[model samples]
Target: MITSIAQAVALFAATNIDDIVVLSLFFARGAKRPHITRTILLGQYLGFFGILTVAAITSYGAVTLLPAGAIPYFGLIPLALGIKAGWDTIRGIDEDEDGAGRSLALPTVAAVTFANGGDNIGVYVPVFVSNSPQVVAVYCGVFLVLVSAMVFLARFIATRPGIGEWLERSERYVFPLVLIVLGIVILAEGHAFGL
Candidate 1:
């Protein structure tokens, strides 16, 4: 159980570190509106639930249909996404520019969260596939707690005047780099390259 908890924490942190910047931006906007913070939180949770649902279902399907030895091939998804993100970065394509000046509604926030989290499904599926059902539940529990911590930290950073701006500006660079590293780590850890 202790090992499961630790694994869950590591997995959640690796997958969701980029979300801090995004949540901070939302919180920054929410600071002005005041009432939208609750909406943002709700939207984040709803979107994350969707991501987890997809991962869980996909992992279960993989476990049922694929041999256990072949499960690590799922790591290819993140590796490919990482390479795409790096390529786009080199081409100076900024996909995060969407939703500028848009109203912060629940649906909008939820949609953005889900879209940003598309890569998370790739990472989660492989890890979840290797874990037992009990361990997966532990992972989910740990993830929920970390999500709350992430929101609180984002709110803190957003409330700080200059920090949010700095993070926003650097997120484009950091995001791709992190994705690339994460993909490599996932692949290496799963020995996907060996297979």
Candidate 2:
């Protein structure tokens, strides 16, 4: 289970790679500003760590407080994130205006980061469902990886050549497809758990 927790954290963080990419794209479109990106990333890290802690605790608490069957019901988490990402990707897949994008405010960045990591909470419920295991360390590992990668991506993209204004034109179709597939998988997992 320790390994699984670690793996889950990795998966959770990796799952957010797209968000980093999208943010990177936005940063590239905007003027390069390490300080701004740092501020945004700080908030982003806080969101990631905060959610992970809550997820670990909630999963542990839920299993003890609720019925065993109710545990899997939490699978809705990653499912939703995947679906949202997929849909958003489809809606904004264009690569235009890569460096002309604006940086988000700290709170907005934090909120977006939280939204991006929303489904990850479900990743924790399973850990507790089986044995009430503690996955905090693994979650922390994932958080570290995510923050590190995000910082690098933001820095790299902010200085890279711009793509002009076209990111939105193409993503419309792509994101929806991602959403549908991710949604189905999550729903399928939910079905299995219910059984």
Candidate 3:
């Protein structure tokens, strides 16, 4: 069970490449206000890690009593989000989001993290059910790694001539497919966990 959870965490984290990439772009945009950027990071950390902790505890408590059948539905969530992301990319809406004109604050970054991490819950439910601290650690580690990757990748791509436009243009075509794949993986995990 623990091993399974670990695998799931690893996969979940790896699947978040798009988000890491998206977030990197946000940071690469010169971070209008350094202090505001820091606040956003703080909020993002607290919101994402904090919620993950809660999910772990909640799963630990109720998993035994919960119907195993309800598991796959949780996986469906990332699928939906991924699909939406892909759709947004396809529809040109993903590129429409720009934080440039806005003032940054703890609430803003935290809010963005919360919105982005919605799919985390879906990917995490099975991990939570397994009651593995290692799984939690894996999640945290994965999150941290992704965050770091986003920061560097975005910064790098931004520095390169024309890469920023390239990324923005590609996500519309690619983002929704990520959601679909995540959804399928989660649903499969749900079935595996049940057995």
Candidate 4:
């Protein structure tokens, strides 16, 4: 359980490294602070839990329909997503942007988060499937707490021009690298590559 919490934190942090920058950008907009903050936080929670719920349901199906030993193969999903994200980053693509003409409403932010979180589901499913139900709950709880912290941290950093600028500039490279490395770790740990 302790290890699960720690792993959950690491996964959440790694997967959300770019979120701080995005949230910072959103905050930099002329919108009211409270409104933007509320939207970001609420959107993050809704998007996160929505992904988790789907992953949990998928986990249930995988656990029942597949052999226990095959569960680790689910790690390949994140590995592939990470590779694609890295490629997109290298190509200067921004899939995280809100859809065309999508206004920055609470629902819009939530939808954007959900859309950008394909890798989240990939990373989440294997973890959720392999763990006991209690551990999954623990991971979800830890993730929710971390999401709040991430919002607060992003808001604080957004208020600082220098730090926010640095994060925005660097995250383009750093975030993809983190995702790739996380994928490698997940694959190696789960033996998803049949190593």
Candidate 1 per-residue lDDT, tens place, 1-195, comes to 999999889888888887786677666544445466688788888888877887798898843433444445544544565576567758876434452422356765565556555567778888888989988999999988888888888788876768767655665565456545645655565576683
Q: Weakest 10 consecutive residues, lDDT, candidate 4?
A: 95-104
lDDT of 4: 0.66
User: Quick one: best lDDT, which candidate?
Assistant: 1
Per-model CA lDDT versus the true structure = 0.68, 0.53, 0.54, 0.66
Q: Rank candidates, lDDT, best first.
A: 1, 4, 3, 2
| Residue 147 displacement in candidate 4 (angstroms) | 0.7
Ranking by TM-score: 1, 4, 2, 3
> Which lDDT tens digits does candidate 2 get at residues 1-195?
667666766676656766655465434433334466676667677767766666666665643344434434443543464465555445763232343333345654455455455456565556445542445555556567767676677557545444322333333443344434544554465574544
Off by over 4 Å in 2: 1-9, 62-103, 128-135, 162-195
Instruction: lDDT winner between 2 and 4, please give it.
Output: 4
Error of 2 at 27 (Å): 1.8
Report the error of model 1 at residue 181, Å.
Answer: 18
For model 4, residues 42-93, the per-residue Cα lDDT tens digits are 9878877777776788788843444445545544544555576568767867
lDDT score for residue 142 of model 3? 66
